[model samples]
Target: MTTTTTLKEQVLMTLKRQQANALVLYLNYKKYHWLTYGPLFRELHLLFEEQGAAVFASIDELAERSLILDGQPVADPADYLGTATVTPSSGQLTVKAMIEEAIANHELIITEMHQDADVATEAGDIGTADLYTRLVQTHQKHRWFLKELLAKGDGLVS
Candidate 1:
C-alpha cells in the first residue's frame, strides 16, 4: 500500500476502536435498561434506551467512515468485543455499576479519540480529525451525563 493508503488503514483502526468502545457501552446501557428497577425505572429505562440509540448511530457512522477510508468496517460483534480496550462485562453488574462503567468507558474513548485526532491531523487526514473531534464532544457529553448521576452520591443512589 501507498503512504496515503497506510495512513487510511491506521485511521480505519482508530475508527474501529472508537466504534467498538461505543458498541460495548451501548450493550451495557441496554442491559441496564432491562435490569434497572427502582422508583427511577421509567426514567432510567427511557434514558438508557435513548443513549443506546445514540451510540448505535455512532457505530454506524464510524463504520461508514472506515469504509470511506478504503477499509472494511469492523461490524462483527465478536470482532468488536474481541478488540475493544474497554473492560469486558460479565453480565453480573448492578444498575449503578453499569452507570459507573459507562462513565469510565466514555472517558477512555475520549482519550483514544483525542490521540487518534492528533495523529490524523498530523497526517493531513482532515476528515478523520473532524470525526474524532465530534466523537470527543459526544463522549464528553456522555461523561457529563454520568457525572450528574455520580456527583450526588457514590453513584449508587443517583
Candidate 2:
C-alpha cells in the first residue's frame, strides 16, 4: 500500500478495526448482563445495559463517520467476529471474572485506539481523531464501572 493513502482509506481501516472491537465488547457486555448474579445483580445489570448502550452508540457513530469519509462500513456480526482482534468468547465464568475480562478487553481496545488516533493525526484526519479520543474516554468509563464491581464485590465500604 502507498504511504500517501487517501484520507477515506485510513479512516475506513481504523473504523473497521474499532468497529470489530466494539461489536465484540458490546455483545460480551450483554452476555455478562444476562448471566450476572449475587447481591450486585441489579446494579451490575443496569451498568452493563448502560455500557452496552454506549458501545452500540459508539459503533454507530464510528460506522457513520466511516461513511462520511466515503467508505463502506463492516456491519454484519459474522464479519465483526472474523475481523475482531479482541476475542469475546471465554465460556462460562463467575460474574466478577466476567467483569475482569471486560476490563481487560476495554484496556486492549484503548491501546489500539490510541494508536488509531495517532494514525488519524498523521493522516490529518481530525474527525477520526476526535472519534477515537471519545472512544478512549468511553473505555475509561467502562473500566471504572467494572473496577467498581470488583471493589463492591469484595465487600469494601466504598
Candidate 3:
C-alpha cells in the first residue's frame, strides 16, 4: 500500500531545507567575511560577519522547529549540500562578486521562506509560520544592505 505524505511531513521537509540553507548561507557569508578586500575592506568585513551571525542564529531555531513537530532535522553536515536550495561559493572571488552572490542567496531565501510560511500556516502550524515570518525579515534586511552597496547613481552632493 502506498502512503501519502502528511502535512506534518511536508512542513518538516521545508524546515529541514531551511535549516540547511541557513548553514550554507552562514558559511558563505563567513567566507566572504574572510576574503573580502579592497577599499571597503573594513566595512565589508564587519557587515559580512554580522550577517553571518544572524543566519547562524536561525539554524538552531529551524532545527528545533523540526523536533517540535515530531520530525528529525538534517543532522549530518554531509547532507546540508543536498538539502539546501542556496548554493555555496567556492574559490577566491572579487569583493563585488561576493556581495552580488550574497544578495542572490538572500533573495532566494526570502522567496522560499514566504512559500514555506504559507505551507506551515496551511498545516495549522502557526508557530512555524511565525518563525518563517520573523526570519524572512532578517534575509530581507541583509538583501537590502547588499543591494545598497551595489547602488550607483547621482546623489544630492554629487
Candidate 4:
C-alpha cells in the first residue's frame, strides 16, 4: 500500500481506539453516578453525570473524525469494552475508588492521545494531530477535577 494509505489506516485505528475508550468511560461514569451512595452521593452523582456527558460528546467527535477520514468507526456497543484500553468497572465502589478509577482511565487516555498525536504529526496529518491534542487537553482537565476531589487539604496534589 502507499504510505498515504498506511498512514490513514493508522490514524483511523488510533481514532477508533479513542472512540471505544470514550464510550467505555462514559458508561462507567454513568454507572458510578447511578450506584453512588453515602454522604458524597449528591456531589459525586452530579460530577459523574457531568463527566459522562463530556465523554459522550467526545465519542461523537471521534467517530465523525473517523468518518471524515473515509474510515468506518466502531459502531457496536458490545465491542467497546473489548476494544477499549481503559478497564471498565462493574458493581459497587466507594466514591474515592470511583474517583481514583476515573483518574487512572483519564491518564491512560491522555497518554495514548499524546502518542497518537505524535504519530499523526509524523504522518503529516495535522488535523488528526490537532484532534488528539484537543482530546488530551480535555482528558487532562477531567483528570485534574477527579484528582482534586481525591486530594487532601490545599488540593495541590493527589
The candidate that achieves the highest TM-score relative to the unseen native structure: 3
**Model 1: per-residue Cα lDDT over 1-158, one tens digit each:** 24656666777778888878778878777788888776667877887888778888888888888888777877676798876787666667766787788888888888999989987887688998999998789788878886787687753444
lDDT of 4 by residue, 1-158 (tens): 24656777888889999999999899899888898776667887898899899899999999999999889898987888777998888667777778889999999999999989987897798999999998799889989988877777443221
- Sorted on lDDT, best first, the list reads 3, 4, 2, 1
Q: Which stretches of candidate 1 lie over 4 Å from their true place?
A: 1-5, 154-158
Residue-level lDDT of model 2, residues 82-117, one tens digit each, is 778878857887876888889899889999899889
Q: How many collisions between residues are there in candidate 3? A: 0
Lowest lDDT block of 10, candidate 3: 149-158
Q: Measured by TM-score, how close is model 2 to the native structure?
A: 0.89
Q: List per-prediction Cα lDDT, in the order shown.
A: 0.79, 0.83, 0.91, 0.86
Q: Which candidate do you rate higher for lDDT, 3 or 4?
A: 3
| Alpha-carbon RMSD to native, per candidate | 2.9, 2.8, 3.5, 3.4
User: How well does candidate 3 match the true structure, expressed as C-alpha RMSD?
Assistant: 3.5
Candidate 1 clashing pairs? none
lDDT of 3 by residue, 8-82 (tens): 888999999999999999999999999888777899899999999999999999999999988999999899999
List pairs with backbone clashes in candidate 4. Answer: none
Candidate 3 runs further than 4 Å off = 1-3, 153-158
How do all the candidates rank in terms of TM-score, highest first? 3, 4, 2, 1
Candidate 1 accuracy as lDDT: 0.79
On a 0 to 100 scale, what is the lDDT of residue 23 in model 3? 98
Off by over 4 Å in 2: 1-8, 152-158
